[model samples]
Target chain A: MKQKRHETPLEAIDRMTDNSVVFVGGFGRAGVPERLVEAVCRRKLRGLTIVSNNAGSNVAGIASLLQEGCVGKIICSFPLAREAVAFRDLYDRNLVDLEVVPQGTLAERIRAGGAGLGGVLTPTGVGTDIAEGKPLIEIDGRAFLIERALRADFALIKAYKVDPLGNLIYRKAARNFNPIMAMAADWVIVEAAEEVGIGALDPEHIITPGVYVDAYCAVTRIDQMMEATP
Target chain B: MTANCGLSLDQMAWRVAQELQDSWVVNIGIGMPLLVPPHVRADRDVIFHSENGIIGMGPEIEGGDHVDPDLLSAGKRPVRLMPGGSFVHHADSFALARGGRLDAAILGAFQVAQNGDLANWKLPGARTGSIGGAMDIAVGARRVLILMSHTTREGEPKLVDRLAYPPTARGVVTKVFTELGVFAITEDGFVLEEIAPGVCADQVRAGSGAQVKTDGATLMVPPDPVSPREPVLSRA
Candidate 1:
């Protein structure tokens, strides 16, 4: 097995291009790849599609990209918040496309993509507008709507710890969407707050195994990144 | 202002807390439902789940000095973990919701129709709605309870005949607790079950945008507590 490449945040994000579908990992600000997001903004890539839980809030993170008009569309569960002015403004002007999904369905779809499944059937949006135009199947006389798996060209994730072999463990609620997105992306770049030796992470505690991660960069300048808006 | 005419926000939260049974796993949404945790009966063992991933959530950390910067609720506020609390990933958190593990979900809403349809995620003419986890929790939880004021900030009734805005889910709301009264969705319509002190059925009917049924039923008044306790701040 090849060792996981260690790259700078800039070098890792440089691999992304225009119109790429990127899965960003974070719940609010807990597990966001701050440096990677900053690098994406600096690169000025446009017409990109982003999948995440929320459009980054008023603080930093993906909101900077939204402010810069780098994102053409977003597939997310929570697309708006009082603090998400950048997203709200862009959306109001028809500058960006938004597909609002239920949170559970969103997670399942991403997980399915990673697991190589055709699709999963869920009852989440059966009677709501979310079910509009989706195929409905009945099993045992119960209704379920088919939700396709969500895979991205690149996944920008944050982890509490990453071993040189690329295994990951997350801290507290920060674990949100990072683990699953790691599996579903063509290239996974993680920003780990701390990087340990290959054997440093215990097998039982590993949330994401080494095989899924392609490249990782240590989070050196936490203060500068964390100070950015949500 | 009608002095002491209805339940205060805390009183409404107190009433909503009364509805929960012991050992039930509950997901509390933003706004009024955030107030439910502090008011729950101390004797009952209720596990609080935040959609962001932490379960067995306790009250907020005091003074903002001791807060763990990484620990936050679904609402993005600092919260303490109760004993036996565990964390899961986002997918698993929703699984707890979608897999029918959550016994009840107390959510806030913009409008609740007589048929139990909820219109809380969006308003009319908004470019994009913040659906969040409303639809998932609305349909996934075993029971859906809505906590909101009877009227909008403009004093317009939120209990309506039909929704003017997009619904979070269809026919999911089981009960609605407002400052004015407790309304349950019946086959007929919204039936008033109880009234707060200083408010009568006629007042509730007049304030409601939809018709309220009060036939052949006595409207019981909620007991007035000597003093409402200060609610423990948990999540924002």
Candidate 2:
């Protein structure tokens, strides 16, 4: 028989070493794994290189970590959406390091990370200073973008439910960045609302399979929330 | 006014073509400017570019039946391709923008100036701002045309003497359009080009917030009218 694998969201995060690269899933606080985010927040991990689609707005979530000095660098697109408070400050003071990724390339990079590819070829920011000094490759007489693969020590996302076996199901826009990050991390953690025994849920509904998951924890709701009004 | 939009939209489209015809390549920034493709005179040839890498783009698909996953417009919506259409590397598409291959670009503006200074990227009080390829297009296009309303929601003029917010491109704009009329940036400053059928030059100037003068010649309006199609953008 195979050894059983299980852990709480906090325990999953506890497994992370300080200053490690982390891949988080969320499109501006939409599907962020609350339990894991809280644990990382409380853990106060420093010098962390974080990757995500958009940093959460001011209240809590990704931007919250920036407030606590927990994040050292970020790779993302449109970091300063309407509700983004911390990012503007960090940008103004030159405190946080940011690498601008064009919107489409940002999505493809995450997908590339999940596909087990070392890097993806793209031409998004080539020639006119977008990808200058970065690696460039031509395939079939056509230029393609060559962006490096990104992996995280810990990956986090919200789930509607997860099997004890670690398969995950997400709800709505909540699916935004969760499933992709799951594929690109060494350890995948889910902070789900319900936990069920394996085989109790439909495999079709599962966004991420247990094959990539390392730990999970059940939680009521993520403490962080952000919007234009918030 | 075209079918779904206002008279302003049609006037702006006409002005854009007047300034940009014979241009080898162009990319209309997303949003209102995205609608310009259908309005452009089919007889005048121009190679259109979309940020999503589709060239020689045509009117959008109504039902999205063929929905090519491999190709979509910058909006991520399914779009039909023209006969000679081709897909380039997405990176190459952007290279065309940054590399200065375009002759003229017509973009929607949040604000413009008497001298055609532009601010279309960010709002100061808003937490986030969009610089999406606008910076690249504005700087690279040899002639930049701004399609915009005369005033903001606050009743302040969009055509200010100077830009109110940080500008994505500096001094690249060539013209402006409003419900009031059309104005072109000239060596001296904003010179009046036309006043809408019922509006006066002074009224257009007052709303524009910049010194305005005219060649004092009657303006010619293109007769081939455009009908705005219902927006294909689904409610997000």
Candidate 3:
């Protein structure tokens, strides 16, 4: 299969629409596809349901939409990037609904989302308030708390490099949730920092297969949209 | 002793970790027990195991520090790995516990029976009440120390002659620590070991559903409290 690479960042986000469920690639401040987040913000898409591990680079990645009150809801393990006045106002007004998940459970749930599991189960939150109203199934009479599946319409992920065939390699923390969420999304768009022409990327270095990625967009300045605040 | 400030969870967690001897490979379940790493004796190498993976976990993280994306605790927050700390497959980490490599495990308990049975995994609220890794850790660890709030948020005592919530590990907890004091469960009954200075023996006994006893006639003196071997909040 040939990998189609988009030359411009705007070309990459033009595929997004209103009410799209997006999964961004970023664990705290690393490997965040700032280009995608900014492009999506420019799209002015509303009622967005973003699924991610965490949000960072305030007003740049996802934080902007959250600041602009564009996103309808956020389902994540944690979200703490937007503490600015605009973002806080929306959150306090009950405009945002946040679901905090146990980290392991959240990871496993994304893995489960990719694997087609009905619901991922663990004991992480069995006795705490995290277990409230979730179905509890027993294996050998040992209790496991259930955390349901999460999916998004589009998975906007960041890759350090990508082969022309769409085989991807992630750098540092970018590898955390991008690959897993890629498999879980209906449309997977990758914003690769570097585009290695076909047959250049080593087979062993490819973390994600070409089949999982729908499109690859070469990004020159991912930092443009991702600015770390003091 | 601190006059009920709500950090009792960490206070009880501290006592539980001190119960372990030197060179103890311990696993502290998420929640209150996570605080134990900060209370361990410096000379003793009290290794902390999170089910996600990694041992010899370091301290609590300052907000917005350099958080390691690789290291995570059972709570799912980024944690710093101490020197010599290594990551393994999470299954392998559980294998270490299930294979009985841990010397002690400090876990939060919802309820403790008169005989030290633990019911830390389930509550009466709703859909789920299943044990996760506690069953494996309980049977595997040499000693099980239960860390819990002595009373509920509503001020109801949780130590009882019988368990009210779902039991995760049966008869596995060796010691129970609450805001009031430490209780050791033997075949005879739950024994009172230490009382937070101002708290009365009658109050601890009255609050607990289990019969309480001390070491013979003499008032039980507590072992020396030591600072944790490593700060539990270091960035990994």
Candidate 4:
């Protein structure tokens, strides 16, 4: 049996290059890979495209990356926040590109990318500005907008627990976008709160199977990165 | 803040809640639609769903002391779990929506067209409006209910002949509950089904940009909570 490889958060993030599309998993503050996001900010790689649910708030997450001026574009559902000055400033200055997608459509697009499907037909954005320039098809007399599958070069995610074989489980709603993102990326690196034995996690409880995960690091100082952010 | 000639925010919520049936699975949108859960009658037994992956959600936790930060609704508000509450991943949560499992969805709107088109996610010159899951819930639920003030703060009517802002969905709004009255989207146009206690038909017509038809419409009375007639029934 092949063993799962483990690396530190810094070592894992060092593999990413400039101009890569990275998917960060979280809804608001939950399920954010704080340590990995900090590593990206500290590395200061530029021209990156990030896909997430929300622009990070004042706290340390993707907000740190935006503050560092590393991201070139953000594809998300909710990009506005009261304390997200970094994103707001860049957006106002036309320094960054923003593509806002509806939450359900975003999830379906990522899931379709992983499932090897071409795209998804959804009624979520029909007759809206979101449907502009997109192909509209009628299925069973109902109108649907064709949303292309969204795949990323790498996905950085946070999980509650992981086994040596890389099977994962998440804590409550913190699971948000992590599992789908894990499947829709070329490489997936997870920051786990706990690392357990190979057979410890129940098969049914495993949200992301070992096949989708490439590597994981047991995060000890997740809060240290947030604390370091001013 | 009370409107000039219509019901209060709480009153509008109560009116919207009256549209729900017992054992219905409902997804509530952000903004004023979030107010509907509090007004649902205890006998209705509605199960609240949040697209962020919570089902059978309870009321917002008052304080942060005992709140689980991770347990939040799609609106990012802290919420408690009902007895049989469950959670799913993002994909599955949307599947429940896209697959047509939701019985009804109550949403807030910027404008509702005469033909039942909905425009709520964006304003004219805002950088970017949050779409969230409004699009999915609007189309996926069996019925889409809207909750909003009758007019904008500038006193312009939100019920319009055509939407100026981007629409969330086409012909998805089945009913609209406003401070002034309840309007149903019929083949003819926006038909006034019920008027608030103090509001008249002329005020509803004047406040709406679209034509408000009062033919066969009757005054709607608020449900009395103190009057009990039958035993409480549970779907479980």
Clashes of each: 4, 9, 15, 0
**Tens-place lDDT digits, model 4, residues B199-228:** 888888888899889767777777644232
What TM-score goes with each of the models?
0.92, 0.57, 0.63, 0.93
- Put down candidate 4 lDDT per residue, A1-230, tens digits, no spaces: 55455667888676788999999998878788988898888888999999999877886898899999889999998888676778898898999999999999999999999999989998888877899899999999988899999999999999888888889998777888999999999989889887888899999889899899887888754432222100
Candidate 4 matches the true fold with a TM-score of 0.93
Q: Candidate 4, B130: how far from true, in Å?
A: 1.6
The residue pairs in collision within model 4 are none
Best by DockQ: 1
Query: Model 2, retained fraction of real contacts?
Result: 0.06
Superposed model 4: Cα runs more than 4 Å off: A1-7, A220-230, B223-236
Q: Which segments of model 2 are wrong by more than 4 Å? A: A1-8, A136-143, A222-230, B1-236
lDDT per residue as tens, model 2, A63-99: 8788888888887766766677887788778788887
DockQ of the candidate models in sequence: 0.51, 0.07, 0.07, 0.48
Sort the candidates on TM-score, descending order.
4, 1, 3, 2
- lDDT of each structure? 0.84, 0.66, 0.67, 0.84
Residues A4-69 of candidate 3: C-alpha lDDT, one tens digit per residue: 677777787767888888888665555567778877777778998887655334456767778766
